[model samples]
Target: MRPGQRGARGRRAAVTERNPGREVSAAKALQKVRGQIRLHLLSHRTSVTASGTLHLKEGDVPYTATSRHQGTASVAIKHIPQELVKRKLLMINGDVHDVPVEVVLILKATGGPESAGSSAAMYLLDWYDLDQELILVLERPVPCVDLRQYLKEKGGSLQEHEAKIMMQQLVEAAIELHSKQVFHRDIKLENIIVETGPDVPRARVADFSCGCFARKGHYHLFSGTPKCAPPEWYMHARYKARPTTVWQLGVVLYGMLDGHPSFDTLRFLRNKLPINSELSQNCQELLQMCLSKVPKQRPTLEQLQHHPWLQ
Candidate 1:
């Protein structure tokens, strides 16, 4: 109830983001908390804004039946606002979460891959039946730093030898997940984790809260961040699920070496998209195959690894 910076375990804890209602440290030392970002929901407070627009996102489930939220991106708003909040706030099996539980589970389940063994991710706690609340234990990576910062500081492009090393590290990790039949639908600078150890920078893909498992024969349609997404993942925008890891892999490769994608535009599929710089022939060719109109045309993870560009 009191608003002031308090000490945690005798160390000073700043009122960092949003103030917490209370901070009681238990045995494990996990902080019982409040949200950093408070959303205006239809929970005994707020008004209706809009309705009737459908949206698509990565993974099997969606934020809503309409109003597309693509890729690893977190949506701050949706078309059917109150309806969605009511479901999240009230808690019901049929209740729809802004972020689908399956997505989070899929991410959590990938503690490790064919080789990763166990990358860090949050653990899910049960929901309260009455209000549809979710409890998650934050499991930060052992040595946490994403590629986004490094990419930005470097100002695009990697040296030949360095690129090769990064490519191999991420590729092997990716192959490990694919072997387990997992598609880390969202792969980008924001998700790759660099451990602070002697190990060769093993990349642990994060944001599985947007990942969907591709069953042996059950294909589900969805969308990803178009900038980095394969055409099959973007064009259909509602097409049945297919193998998109290959596509995303290519995009990330482009991003790593170039700082951005071959396409410099933001939200390529969205309106008001600006003119993007031309991509190099090698990069364009790779993106072309990855962004092929058809899903079946894209190369497999192993095949992409062996491509001439990689060589």
Candidate 2:
């Protein structure tokens, strides 16, 4: 169930300061704040704010060093949002929650905000629009690493039991996302963050820049990783949300068990890479069902949640 939207009393004071005598609804006041907060914060930071630089107060600067730039996105740490703090939304791996932050800020800045709602699997804390670039503040799980690096540390492939635990969590996350009408097009190892500090490793799905709202029709334009795309995108040049998501889940599982990247669409179409036979029969069956060439043959997210392999 989605979190109940709580009215923010603080917004009234801010709204009344600007427009005296004019009463504004809490929703409208929140919308106004979302629109103005980014510009207000950016302008008050310094005399001159660099195009891509995130300047915090002295000794509070979060970024230490720089690295090679690949895509348009880059990572840097900074302060948390006071707005979010006011709502008491900050917590470490807490219960599932949602903040009533405007969707426009996230959607306009990141191109993907459909999945930004409450989910233990996602860590979208807050976001700001800096005109030239967008600033996204995500939750950092201490003593954690990406699933790809974690796999390498585990001798390149995870044991069936470990993989089963991780896959069960991921499938549950997928079901939650599906219930909220959020289709995360990219569900790969690199995008998944695993918290190793816990007794059992916990997985948190990250990177929703390729996400969109779940719909009934097929989507022609694919925004996720090319190699991990479903076969329908290659053969038919179109794919639906759930089927494609299942296909990507299959790719993630294949990567975890095989310790190698899954095949590209063309190679998968030709059946160049097969599921590892050494895996248990249930695991192999789930892989086969998910990696089916025909989208219709693949099990739904609900079925995956109840699959014998996961159980």
Candidate 3:
């Protein structure tokens, strides 16, 4: 996932104070990186970021360099990696030549905050910080496509079985993240990528730039895409982590099957289009439970996992 996923215009900045010291040159800093340039000036999708492809000479590891100038001091741009190092090497097909391991670059500003919680659910390969830039060396999921692009290839929507499989993996990932007290403020199709294997494709969650460590009764400020914000946030100006996550899950499920969001406004979510005959009965029930107008009425991740639709 990229920093520009979901609503970039409304991204929350790094909660830490800005570093006012003399900035280091990003290009000069990258020169010291232990890698060969495979692709120079790679086209980064977001204008706010610049990225390139790199090949680590040490282990023949392939990685992607995602970087952004601290220009405009964007909150997502301030998302740099913490010092915690966790490594995993997934050997797909039992062949080293196959897909490499998916290493997520979980970032937090240096000396910003303790991020033991946020990095709990993913692997941190390597990270570096310059005075004005934070660069991450992330393992790219090869032979994979983003959920959004995959949906487009499927004529804008997914089949029921395919949707079920993808959503199951995503739900499990969400539950694991929440278990670590890490709130992935943004969860959308764009943030998930599916590996295209010969038999079964797996969905992997990416891009923790908008994520933060949070526990019950701790998260208060708005931190995600406005469209995914729950009714409680709009009506009462505050929202809890669990309920809002459930709402975002509902929105993503709907988008997967319907090719678009279920509703655009709080009024619409509360008063209009409450039913969808296109989906199975259990699936519809799950959506209703997740998209409930009242946060208290929404299902917890535990309850959602036991739902019939997922089973």
Candidate 4:
């Protein structure tokens, strides 16, 4: 919390921009992408929701959905419009011509309040609930794949430059999440999607079912992949928000560059296997700061973004 100079006011503004509390009309959202978008929901699959199982047709522009679904229909629909509008603006302003749209589907069981879950921005196209299954739709980046698969395809490790690009965007996205008072408890290779075909692929942090609103500095329970757990969690049985986030980012960076995580347990993180020697000294230093055994020693989100390696 004390690692960065970003003030409370600045943080508030950033949070306000993507706060998820903001509401967008579902009818209007449906109207915006009605003819252009199509959703194909798979049935009889064991998974509760068909979030990542989708075949979308958007006016001949096509992409699969890689989304995370949770309890609320509202939260599931909220992120869709923001993504579509974001990509549209980027194209209009000529900022990046080839940015991919992020699509998601929320498959929820038939009985839950619409507003009980995590925060979501207001954008609902259309959602249907039938036979105890709720199918929600959204968009995702095209010509891209999950980071886990990408790493495997690259023979376990990514080139330094590619890793840098992915981490930068990921760090930025993390900052945005923290600013919005959201803690993405699950930050791993599978949850991060890499936009392919660019000279340097961009990354987006996807999936929010495992996330929740950060209340104060303490979160009593842990709800994420065990591989990314911090040492403090194993020691004290509960983890704070910011430090846990820093530790997860470290795990992610290490996995990207080394082709695998250095440690999966507190005992192992305390004695993290030697970092890959191929990494530059600065990159290594950043990883050291992030993977620190002591929670307090870890960098804040703001500080991590400006770390020398990322710059």
Candidate 5:
């Protein structure tokens, strides 16, 4: 039971933009903030942000602080109930190293255009913006069993429909972002969120703080969770960062159905394993096609949508 999971149903709310104006592009609204909490944020084991989030450790309690984050000139202050207040916080660079998803890094990363579309890969939420007292809130991540956990729970077996549904959701989300020209450098089970609520478990892609906007060319990032990453991503981190997202998704889809990785066996010996054969050939082929090392050979999200398994 993660923070977002509600009941045994493993259901999650639809990952929708609840508040429309609630979105504040840290890039666009930079100078709008006011009242920076003047405090020396220090943490012994707590995590922090690069440009905004701060964590502090006091005696035995931990405090989480959101520095006027990105956007706005000067941020505002908001009131927090005594119960909601965490103590002993630490603040650092834009990294915000210690947070639920390390999302602060995306704020530091170059974001795509405001019209980046539904899958733009990231969004700026306006949670706390009053008198420096930040009201930090985050999106309700999708609540579905991660591949590894799913395998363990299912003993390495998943229905074809289940695997296809998950892959379709991820591919569609990627399509949305691609249409808007935003490149999500990282895509893995740890990052892919699924809404488990009775609402068809809409899968939402997340973690774009490390994404690319204008594509000055991949900068080789040690992004992507280890198991789901493409071989090229591991070898050439910076320059080949985002292009491999599709491949990662493929690997994730394969692992979901087969209970193991789809990459090279020797290289990924530590990662590779066997999987269940409870899926249709069409679906497996689709997964393998996406995992192709040749980026161009990977089916576009649009192409994937029309996949026979999906059809």
Candidate 6:
């Protein structure tokens, strides 16, 4: 069965069996709560910055400027939310310690609870609502660049071994996001930052503008990049979260190996786009499995973690 078809049918059956009025009321309540959350966040315009912990430094430069998004850097601070500090979410040189706060300011475009602690993902240290513009205070890893720029500086592609190291970390990050019920709808080179200070580059997933809370059921709306969307979305107009995530991982891997723009979904579906044959057998297999036209054929995040190429 196509993805979400079963769920759609089941929902239809339940609609016929349950009280329609109650369902409508429940949906309204959910929307009301979401609205309240937004209002609360917007009302706290200066609470974060006023706390004296986070300082917006002068002479801020564009940290990561892509056609899609941009971020600015600021000075380091000593204080952060106690919850984040307790969780030891921030890492400096691969160690969990009380370190100074280096922040990047990204214009917030999405609404959700703060991101959960994951070293593989950038930490949302603080946020401010300024005159209807929401700005996110994100952790800034010193001496790092976005993966897209990194790839460009490295001659457009990474070697298989180097790619493996980064890919493994990315896969683990995806798993952690899902486990925390956060669905990072867009996972691509531009949204990932590569920390060059480390011996082996560490990948930190960033930019959650297209993200939402992970939930069971089909997401009818598609907010991610069109070129990177899964085939299932084009064919059925609906997609499940996990399958879509796996497909994006494949897209990232393909770009890393091919040293080209991500394959157009339509071209790939038409079979005009092919995986590079020069890649090793294990790498090719992993790519093939991830880019499978059938969503069910793709390996789960856990399976990807244990894939031979990554191992």
The C-alpha RMSD of each candidate to the native structure, in angstroms, is 12.8, 13.5, 15.5, 17.5, 14.2, 18.0
User: What ranges in model 4 sit over 4 Å off?
Assistant: 1-131, 261-263, 270-272
Question: Which digits, one per residue and each the tens of the lDDT, describe model 6 over residues 1-311?
Answer: 12211111013212222477755654454345434444433343222221112111223221322221125553222223222211112232343332112221121122233533335566654432222223345666777888889999999999999899889988988887676556777788888888898788888888654565566688877766777889988899888889899999999988888888656788988888888899999999999999999989999999999999999
Best TM-score among the predictions, by candidate number:
2
Model 6 clashing residue pairs (backbone): none
**Pairs that clash in candidate 2:** none
Candidate 5 or 3, higher TM-score:
3
Once fitted onto the true fold, the runs of candidate 3 whose alpha carbons sit more than 4 angstroms away are: 1-122, 261-267, 270-275
Per-residue lDDT tens digits for candidate 5, residues 267-302, read 443434433344567876786677665666777667
The lDDT per prediction is 0.45, 0.63, 0.54, 0.55, 0.46, 0.63
Candidate 5 regions with alpha-carbon error over 4 angstroms: 1-124, 127-136, 141-157, 214-216, 234-243, 261-278
Candidate 1 wrong stretches, greater than 4 Å: 1-108, 111-132, 216-220, 237-242, 261-288, 308-311
List, residue by residue over 1-311, the lDDT tens digit for candidate 4.
11121121112112233543322333343333332232111131122221111222223222134354434421223223212221111212222222112222222111122422221221233443222222334334446687899899889988888888888887877776666455667688877867676777767666554555454455556666666778887777778878888888888888899876334755455565668777899999999899888888888889998888888
What's the TM-score of every candidate structure? 0.53, 0.66, 0.61, 0.60, 0.53, 0.65
| Per-residue C-alpha lDDT of model 2 across residues 90-207, encoded as one tens digit per residue | 1223332223222221232222334432344544344443222234456566667889999989999999999999999888878766665567787889878898888999887775
Better of 5 and 6 by lDDT: 6
Model 5 is weakest, by summed lDDT over 10 consecutive residues, at 34-43
Task: Give Cα distance to truth, residue 60, candidate 3, Å.
Answer: 35
Clash count list over all predictions: 16, 0, 4, 8, 61, 0
Window of ten residues with lowest summed lDDT in model 4: 1-10
Residue 82 error for model 2, in Å? Answer: 24
Per-residue lDDT over 55-153 for candidate 3, one digit per residue giving the tens place of the 0 to 100 score: 212222122333332333212122332222122222223322111112222431111124322222333334443332344544444466777898888
